[model samples]
Target chain A: MAKVLLKGNEAVVRAAIEAGCKYFFGYPITPQNEIPEYFSKELPKIGGAFVQGESEVASINMLYGAAAAGARAMTSSSSPGIALMQEGIGYISKAELPAVIVNMMRGGPGLGGIQPSQSDYHMCVKGGANGDYHNIVLAPGNVQELVDMVQEAFDIADQYGMLVIVLADGLIGQMMEPVELRKPKARPIEPKTWALTGPNGGKPHRIYNLKLQAPDLEQDNIDLFKKYEVIEKNETRYEDYMMDDAEFAFASYGTASRVVRTAVDKLRAEGYKIGLIRPQTLWPFPYEAFKRPNIKKYLDVELSMGQMIDDVAIACGDKNMIEFFGHTGGVLITVDEVCDFAKKIMGGAK
Target chain B: MSRIDRIFCAGFGGQGVMSMGQLLAYAAMLEELEVTWCPSYGPEMRGGEANCSVTISDERIGSPLINNDATVGVFMNGAAYNKFKNKVQPGGKIFMNSDLIEDSNPRTDVTYYKIPVNSIATRLGKIQLANMVMLGALNDQAHLVNQDMLLEAFKKVFGAAKEKYIPINKEALAEGAKAAAEMFK
Candidate 1:
């Protein structure tokens, strides 16, 4: 396959088209505006639909409507916009709707600066609307993964009957890279037996998260928890680099993970045996990978900040082996800082 | 495997610094080496300075960050030179656009090559392609990558519709290369 130069935003839209997705609803936001712009031009060419909704809230609701109608639908927004759509996302999760949402996160607590940031780590994994629900979040580091994960996101959303998120950041969204567009596979146009496709033959099918009856609502929550358990058991993914002979490891995800990978390589070349543990799936968190007896003996934790360290501590048993370093509000932690931390840990200087 | 060569290119936003780094990385990939090209942008990309990093190696690259001692530094503007001059490795080469950079000051330990990239681009009838000219010069001086590989990278980037620009770009590349070779001699 020949490579084509594409920005990260454009790559996601192209991947959506290749994943058999026919509907996209989104509003413009910094660092991710290119996504909606690309979809506006390309979706119509393929007989697909792209709508710039009135707001992120309306956009996510449109996704909900399309997914309920058994169409492959998606929406994208940045940190602030995503926060606005949280209520709608809660509805989609409660209703078990199959849809993909993209969060090209920018730095934020409120109206934060427009720079790439992993500040949304907690929001994406732990803050999906309101109740007891989890959205399968896929974090992509580069444009290639951005393209590949979009397709994978759709499949995961449909198969699990839940909302899926492709998490990226301003850096990944604005960057350009060479990508080969994959040929889309033909999928079944018919909705699943459980989907609310208007009473296929006999009884009318209704889809909604609101079950006023206590017994029915309890059963629904139980069923959703069970599905999450299965996902936890089966779907965690992580990449390990140079860990076999290392005495310490740095853990990071998304764009920060890529930076950690470079730092690890440089440290290795300088004769420091440092390793990197990068999680591709943020929710299930790949706890088992770090829990391995060998890795436990050699692992320390690192994050954009103290956010993901909680997961690391949980995974590594809170043994004080985990160390945290970060600069908040979109400030990038340099490779030198990470190397110094690894050196101190290895040299027993701390 | 030996360490991957990581290069950082920095300049104003419209200088095509990102494109230049990407072309080099892509060319290395065509040579069957592993490569990664990551551009820095955001609010920092609008009218502010922009930069990118390219890592090319015999094995898979773990990350794409360029540390203080990077293998190569290409500065297309005075601001880039001022910001990154101290970061180049002792023996590493610093490529600067002589047309825009009036001051040739750099660390005494590192070798600096000043190429008139903007002037060459003006001569070529397209001033925006100055970045390409600088890339051509760097490719010749470093020989870290092959000319054919660079051309293949350009083909991948520009595609067929813009095929006509190939000859002009190649000419620009060749002119820059020849000028750099002469300066070193």
Candidate 2:
């Protein structure tokens, strides 16, 4: 397939289509409205379905209904709108249903602003929904990564029958870049024996989020824990850049990692031992990558005011030597600033 | 020539700021270069101020957001000019629409070309063609992208219906480029 220029929002939807997503239910929000708009026009051409639900709450529930019925379903929203979908997300996770949700985060504690932000890190990775389960969060640093991660999000969701979220910021969502849209190999069809579809030739199955007895719920939790253990072992992914002799390491994800990469590259060229550890999966956070024996100091860079910093601190296991740099509420940091900060941190490193 | 070009364009919402950035970004893509286009999306973009940042590089781009150090700036109005005037990198170039912007205090460190892009487009009888004129002026100054690539972008954007206006757009672009050549000489 030839490459085409696509915005991050449009690229995700196109990837979803190639991944065999047949149903989409979403509400419109700034920076990500392109997703729903593209789907509404293109999904029908492929004999798929697209619905603009009454609200974010309604849209996510619509996704739940579709996914429970044994269809590849998805929904997308920005921060506040994603917050509205948390209960539904919890229900989908509890029900053990497969669905893809995209959160193109914006600046927010409320309706903060319609700009790119990474502040929703804690809300997303820490389980915004009230539950014992966590989403398989895939964060991408660029538009190409966003496209690939969207396709992988669907496959991972079906492979584990779990919820997978692509956590991107408004910057990546709205940015346009050239992407090669290939026809992905069809995902192996998983047997949905527990689907809510009416019995035709087999015994009927009932699937819901409710488990009444304490013992039974505990057993379910135990089962989920077992599945999570497998995911933790098999799914943790991170990229190590110039870590061979890194005395100082910077940990970041998504767009922030992009900035840090340039800074690391520039600093490395200038005889600094600074490297970068970029986690592609925010959940099952790659703790192993941070275990560099020679690393003297760790800096966690993010677009938010250090929400992911806590995870970096935990992953590094030595919070004493950890530092954080970020800007919140839609403010962005530059590569030169990051390089300067890295130089300053190296000056103070032990 | 710089290895990477980071260009910013700003104007009122309807002044084709986003389209100007998109045209250049698309042309860069056609040349198989790494590119990114990020628009300022918020309430201000609804019918008021709007801007877009574009980066074309041989290497993968870092951040799409440009807080400072834009290699080139295309301003269509006074507000846009005032907002982005200081952000241009020293020795970088700025192409200002003199029809809409009155002030042209050129910075000693940066080069400024005051092209009445809107006036040229209006003379072509399509005020909306101002973005193409600006693009032409940009190409003439920076040589950031090839002329043929941009014409191909026009074909891709306008499709089969371009026959009626392709010549007009080509004239607009050429006129703008010619204006740029004459000014520099």
User: Which one is best on lDDT?
Assistant: 2
What candidate 2 gets wrong by more than 4 Å, as runs, is A183-189, A348-350, B44-47
Relative to the true structure, candidate 2 reaches a TM of 0.96
Worst 10 residues of 1 chain A by lDDT: A295-304
Stretches > 4 Å off in candidate 1: A3-5, A177-191, A196-203, A269-273, A294-303, B1-3, B44-48
Listed in order, the DockQ scores are 0.49, 0.72
| Model 2, span A1-350: residue lDDT tens | 66788899999999999888989999889879999999999999999999999999999999999998989989999999999999999999998889999999999889898878898888889999886998999999988889998998888898888899899999899889999876545566578877888988888877868988999999999999899999999899998888887899999899888888878878877889888899999997898888878998898899888888888778778798798888888888889989888878888443
On residues A1-350, what C-alpha lDDT tens digit does candidate 1 reach at each position? 86665778889998998898989999999989999998999889988899999999899999998988888989999999999999999899998888999999888888787888887888888875788889998888788888988987888888788799898988788766667777534443335676667886799878876888999988999999999998888778888888787667788877777767777877877887678888889887898767755443333333245677778878888658677766667777677776776676677421
Q: RMSDs, each prediction?
A: 2.9, 1.8
